[model samples]
Target: MNTGSETQMGIIPPLFCIKCGLEHRLPILIMTAITEQAIQDCMTQIRQKQEPHHSLEIQKYAQLRLMDFAPLLGEWGIDDPKNTPKAKPLPNVAQAFQAAELSAEQKSKLLNYLQQAAKQGSTTAMLYLAYAYAVGKFIAQNPTKAVECARIALKHQDYRAARLLGEMLAFAPALASDVLQNDVQIAAQNWVKTHPKLAQNAEQIPQLITQYLHNPIVAKFVAKQKLQQAKTMGSPIADQRIRGLSMIGVLSSSQPARQYQSIENWLENQLAAAHMPIESDDDMMILPEHMPLMVQEDDDVPVWHKAAIVGGFLLSGAMITLLIIRFLVK
Candidate 1:
């Protein structure tokens, strides 16, 4: 009933079309099926092999397996099987970055490959090039170039690129004043709406924008607004902490006196809460002697104050009166 050749040249013979009852030269279909099957087989073999060297061999074999479909894909006018319009490749930039720790040379080579592919109009490649440039991976740092590449990728409906580009435009200095910022924001919002899972990462984009691009004034306002929203919505604390720290760092760097006062006030309040007397006008509380012994006290003081008491005890003969009062309250 079936007379198709079953050789191992990695080719699947044409099959009869059920609708027409006639054989169709669907080489692309057959090629995809065969290639996928071969890839799976190779992966299975790699997984089953116990030897590390054999596993490496299997990996190499798997990498090259796609080459077998080149001729068939060529006949169907598909030059890049992995990056064909119908078969957009997966994002590999993150994986490449993770590998950067192990091999700088390999990372460079991969980035070069991505750049080349991007220049050839591969959306996925463009996205990766933007990511690589944004992070300065194996290349000179160029946020402007990264944003440009991302825009091009976004034009091709590359949502990942759109998201990253949106983040960059929102925060990166290169596109700070450009109209592309709004475009990027809208695109990113649309993407998150479409892919609900992306919403989690979406919240961080605004912070990233503030960190990388916004002026000090704008940064402070955005950070304050985000912190307020975070407090009310009970958003992820880690995210809020990150944004808060960055904002505080910027504020401290730009406004030293004001920042110092804020810190001092916070410290004073904390010390008062612990019933510790303000020791220094500038530094707040004094360290006590015998820190280990102070910490060994089972009291209801905040952990930080307890640690401070222990540190104070270790440092000098600072009056233990405040510490005693804190314990009394407990």
Candidate 2:
């Protein structure tokens, strides 16, 4: 299915090692150390001809390591020891999505390139494909295909996919109930798998997941002013998001997700989320916006009941006025 944006090749199933776990907060030095070790391990496997066999959720740590060196990966850092990339991956995921071309042939190069990169485990690449199919941009409208992409990306451990699927659960056309249900089930499983490390672990995570937590790229990630802002908000989802950003890598950290999210607005959202409350503790008895919009039959009172309540208030007022007058006269 290669169409020339990249070299002729089968678009592998773009997988991510997205984290479904809680958090991986670490200082710069520690993070640097972790990244160095992860690179060694990943390269070791690459050189040994062994495939990454960790669970999709566990691969998130690797995802960060790969992204830490994306510049190199894009260049000759980790090419096929046998053949180099034809032309330093075109248009990245950003430039490709921004083009105004409407013809499929014109877009084939961009689409094929992204597909190839995604198949190679590029988070942005997978994300781009999810949005392309979901919205039918240069592709057919296929919510099922969109769901499949987002779902696999979710298992790879990105929150944007979860967020996209959640939105689709309410808005995407024609998705079967099971597809939506499975989205939830997968998310829950990922959350649980990493629950113990949600906010209170680092040394405990198995090496498979932590091998790359140390890296200059990761230090840049944790040190991002925006990333710090996300952590300060202190919501569970925020915690997952910070981890998501780390899993996504610093290169695309400035990029977008869930259809590019106004340019990764999901990640950029941390800046905007600064004003948001960690949780709404207001006891003002507000109903959720998603609740049924129809009138509440039980809450509706009869005309007579409304009239009686009004009349009773008037009568009480008159009685109070009369009593005040009598006291003044005395």
TM-score against truth, every candidate? 0.29, 0.33
Model 1: worst 10 consecutive residues (lDDT sum): 1-10
- The C-alpha lDDT values of all candidates are 0.41, 0.41
Best by TM-score: 2
* Steric clash count of candidate 1: 11
Candidate 1 per-residue C-alpha lDDT over 108-155 given as tens digits, one digit per residue, 9 for 90 to 100: 678778777777777767765655555445654344466577667656
Candidate 1 residue-wise lDDT at 251: 21
lDDT for each residue of candidate 2 in 1-330, tens digit (9 for 90 to 100):
111122111221112223633332222221112233443565466447587453322222233222232222232222232222221233445555566554667688877877888787664566567666655567753444666886666565544444444434322112322233233224433543544333233233222122222222322432343334423432134445446645665223553223222212222232223323344456654434322245656768889999999999999999999999999999
